[model samples]
Target: MRAMVYRGPYKIRVEEKDIPRIEHPNDAIVRVTLAAICGSDLHLYHGLMPDTRVGMSFGHEFIGVVDQVGASVQNVQPGDRVMVPFNIFCGSCWYCARGLYSNCHNVNPNATAVGGIYGYSHTCGGYDGGQAEYVRVPFADVGPALIPDWMSEEDAVLLTDAAPTGYFGAQLGDIAQGDTVVVFGAGPVGLVAAQSSWLMGAGRVIVIDHLEYRLEKARTFANAETYNFTEYDDIVVALKRQTDFLGADVAIDAVGAEADGNLLQHVTSAKLKLQGGSPVALNWAIDSVRKGATISVIGAYGPIFSAVKFGDAMNKGLTLRMNQCPVKRQWPRLFEHVHNGYLKPSELVTHRVPLEHIAEGYHVFSAKLDGCIKPLVVPTAA
Candidate 1:
């Protein structure tokens, strides 16, 4: 098997590796058909996430065919195509029973925060991801679902993480009828969040980003107003002005860890690793929403602390809601949306690179070259 191996910060390569075998009674081995490089994967790629060791693969959004299943795996069988959610969770835990799969207590040893994520880092349970020919899926019965006959391979792959997370971000916002929602960042997640906001009954949607291409995507794909924050002297003030000086009814921060717009914050957090992540986007979200509005944060941040405007949020009585997306929880509605042509998850895909050329794929995506947004990885053997 050939897998993408992380060597160090900003370095990765395709290397031959042994095929993974079932290690637990509930485990299954999947032959990956399609996988996506998520925006959050860049955190691990750039050494922003803690314990992202060398030789580990980085991917969480993937769909594959079941190559083999363990004795206890009953939901799927060999030869079945399945969509694997990013979270590896046991369905019977207290958190899982409550539909909080991302905080499942029975998966990760360090389950104080995030549960289990594929190929995310030691802090996320150290499981290898599916950016390869094969991957080992634990708790297979709970995490994977057969791909719907109507779902495209690209759509199935995005549902594993990026699409679901974006929907989850909108879900956290609790948008009311006629609410004006503002989204930070215009990456895959942000674009999806902006689009989902409309489905959630938001009267208006706005997306902010520094890139022209992504802002344009928000305008075209999401049918939302777009703003290039780089053009404003103070983006928060600009957002307030756009909302008639009262601020937006809701704000979503989809950019995490590597947010720009500040020199000292970016240097101390993203560059020097002094803080968990740059707080620019999150802070902007804090100030851009109305005093009593809601803010949803779906961005990936390091385990360490970062500078955030907690005081202002408390003073303004803002509702702050965020968590890793419980991917499977959003599947039912997302499937319906897709079936009805209400959403097209595949439209977010910008590039598909073979596993052999993943090194180049990572470079292109990390550098944001050629308008790369969501890049898919296909196994060489596929």
Candidate 2:
């Protein structure tokens, strides 16, 4: 089998490797049909993720056909199409039972709070990712989502990460009916956040980004108003103007560190681009809201610690919630939304390239070329 192996920082290549097989009663092996690269993967690609092993497979967003299954996996049988969760977890854990699957203690043995993940790093759990011919899935009965036969694989792949993460962000935002929601970054995650806000009944959805292409995609495809941050010297003023000079009801930071701004100056700066709902965004959101608004952050963040101004947050009487997105918790609902035709997250797919040309796919996706939003890696020949 040929898999895209991570050689080192900023290095990945397609190389021959042994195909994975079911190794436990809870295991299953799926022949990856379609997989998509995530912006989080770029952290690993750029060497931001620590303890990244050389030659580890690198992908997490995927949907596939169950080529093989263990005896205990009775819910799904061979030939069942499924979308694997990015986070690795055992269903019987305390957290899993509580629906906090991402922080499952048994699955992510490598970390103190959360255990493991596919294609992330040693820090997250060193399971190999799905950017290859076949991937071994653990806790298959509990973790893998059965894709409805009616849905296309390409369309279903987004649920594996971006769509669910976006939905998770919105759900965390706890937007009220007719509430205003503002999402930073206009990337796939940002687009999903905006879309989810609308689905959650937000009256006004504002997407912020400097890229005209991304902003255009948000406005045209996602049906959200977009702000070209480059055009405005003061984005806070624009946001306030839209919100009657108050901040948004819910402000979600989807870009993490990728967006431009200072992390500490969140309270004072009108334009704050910290992680999802950074102190800056939080402050602005507090200002945007009517004294008791909720803010949710689903953007990826590193371990680098920063002091949050709780005093300011307390004064505003704001609610702050952030999660890595227990993606498994949202998968079933996302699948239902997709099946019902209420959600068309496939709109995020801007490029599709064969597995043989994955390097080209990375080049284009990383460069954000040709207006790329989310590039799907078609593993098998169509």
lDDT tens digits by residue: candidate 1, 224-267 = 99889889999999999999999999999999888989989989
Lowest summed lDDT across 10 adjacent residues in model 2 is found at 268-277
Q: Give the TM-score of candidate 1.
A: 0.99
Total clashing residue pairs per candidate? Answer: 0, 5
Off by over 4 Å in 2: 261-290, 307-311, 380-382
Q: Which residue pairs overlap in candidate 1's backbone?
A: none
What lDDT score goes with residue 158 in model 2? 86
RMSD of each: 0.8, 3.7
lDDT of 2 by residue, 1-382 (tens): 8788887666778888888867789899988988999988876776666677898988988888888889888778888888888888887788878888788888766776555678888888888898888899988888888887787776688888888888898999998899888888788888888888888899999888777899998988678998886687677787888778667778887876343444354322212322222344444454555557777777665554434556766887888888777888887677788888777888778888888788788878766789888998877532
In model 2, the clashing pairs are: 108-115, 108-116, 246-288, 247-288, 266-280
